[model samples]
Target: MDILLFLIIIFIASILQTSTGFGFSILATPFLLLLFEPMEAIQINLLLSLVISAVLIKKLLKDVDTGILKRFVMGSVIGLPIGMMTFLFIDLNLLKLGISVIILVLTLLLVMRFRMKQYKKRDFVVGGLSGSLTTSIGMPGPPILLYFSGTDTKKEILRSTTLAYYLFIYSISLVVQLIFAGTSKTVWVSSGIALPLVLIGLYVGQKLFVRINQTTFRIFTYIILLFTGLYLLLESL
Candidate 1:
């Protein structure tokens, strides 16, 4: 039953991620913690997220925002090491509690029609936040999602740029995890089992993306953010 349930979780999460370019880990990680140990769950989420990015990179490359991507990558390089240190020393539940609150508040603000100006270095800031969050919580989508949503970026650019950035961040994260925090064999086995489901979800999700407009995409993103924030809050409690 756990195996069956795990597949379902990954499939649905993959669909959201593939469609929006930023949700697989946010939607999947908390549930994965229920099915596996913390490190194992995190490793699985990272590995699967890498797969999602790899699969979508070719398709989404045309829409990638190179200028934004450059800043995000540079900022992420600084943030990754800090996140690794935090993962080792910080109280994860406490950190998660903080993140959850931020997610909730930001999501609410976005829903209230709050918007942000596009500053020159905003992508860098968002990317740094995303990188730290990725390693600390195994979920990076919230910061980028919030930033893009706040700036009211176009759906195509948002999806492509985020997906492109994930490829870089997820790869670095996996290497860091492997070096500093080794994974058990079970992590590999489980990720292998879920790969097919992830692929299927990606296929279906890409189809759905074609039909979704900006308004629909934003609404969908907000729903995911709300659920993610609520889930993290409940988990922390």
Candidate 2:
């Protein structure tokens, strides 16, 4: 029964990630938390995210906006350690509620169509904030990146850029977890099972995104985020 739920959630989350380049962690982590401890869930999710992002990197390398990726990644690098430190101090319930709030606010922005739609100046801000929040909250923040990119090019540029960002962040997290948490074996085993699901999910999401128009996609996006926010909010209690 648990495995079934894991597979189902991974499929949906991965598809969401494949098409939009964000939300896999946000959507999947909360579901995973229902079964696993928050720390374990995040570690495995990060590992799976790293693997999936690696698989997609080659295809999206040329498409990636290096300028945007670099600044975002650099900003993330600076903030990640701070977030990790802070995360260590916070209780699981608080973590869940905080992430729920972030998802709620972002969902509202998406529903109201308040994205900046510009990549240069706004991307730097978005990238920095996403980096910090992703590290702290485990959301990975592609929706924030999507809004900052402010163009339909999110399927391409933002997707590729976010893939790169996760690869980096998760790599760091893996090492940190091994050193700090000592749950590497458990996290690795679960991630091995989840990895294939992630790939399959992306394939499905890619197909969905390709077939749908932007407005239609955004509607789906908002609905999913609202649900994710509510899910986290409920789980936090």
Candidate 3:
């Protein structure tokens, strides 16, 4: 049953991630926890995310603006190490609740029509915070990117740039985890199982991207985030 459920989640996560450049792990983590230890789930998800991102790296290569990726990755480089260190002392459930609340409030603000241009250097700031949250709580970082860049730059530049940045951050964090987190072999093994699911999700999401209208996308994002926020808040207790 757990395996059955994980299969379903992988597809959904990939779709969300591919479509919005985020939400894969945020959607996957709670479900994964039912079958994996928190540390193990993070390890597995990070590995799988790295793999999936790498596969898409070439396609997005030309789209990525190295100038932007540099600052974002630089910010992440600083943030992830600190996050990894902080993870040692924190109760993960508390962290999840905090992130959920933050994202929830942010979603409401998004619904209220907050312009992305209003936040200067926002991607850099979000990348840092997202790196920290990813380390501590396993949330996907690109929504942080989504929130930062305006729709005008979203597809042509921001998404690829964000991917380049997230790649480095997740990789760096993965190395730190391998050395210090002491996740078990099962986590490494499960990542292999999860990879295919990620690919399928990515494929489907890529296919759907061109077809989704803006209004529909906005409505969907709002709905998913509301549910995500509620899920975390409810589980936190």
Provide the overall lDDT of each model, using Cα atoms, as 2-decimal numbers: 0.91, 0.70, 0.71
lDDT of 1 by residue, 156-218 (tens): 999999999999999999899889988899999999999999999999999989999999999
**TM of each candidate vs. truth:** 0.98, 0.85, 0.87
Worst 10 residues of 1 by lDDT: 118-127
Candidate 3 lDDT by residue in tens digits, 6-101:
788878988877776555666787788778887888887788777767877787789887876666676676678667777888776687678678
Q: Give the poorly placed runs of model 1, Cα more than 4 Å off.
A: none
Compare candidates 1 and 2 on TM-score and give the better one.
Answer: 1
What tens digits encode model 2's per-residue C-alpha lDDT throughout 126-213? 6666655555556656446446434545456666777877778778766765565557466667777877788888778768766877
Model 2 lDDT, residue 197, Cα: 81
lDDT of 2 at 19: 80
Each candidate's clash count: 0, 1, 0
What's the distance in Å from true for residue 2, model 3?
1.3
After superposing candidate 2 on the true structure, give the runs of residues whose Cα lies further than 4 Å from its correct spot: 117-122, 142-146, 149-153
Clashes of 3: 0
Ranking by lDDT: 1, 3, 2
**TM-score top scorer:** 1
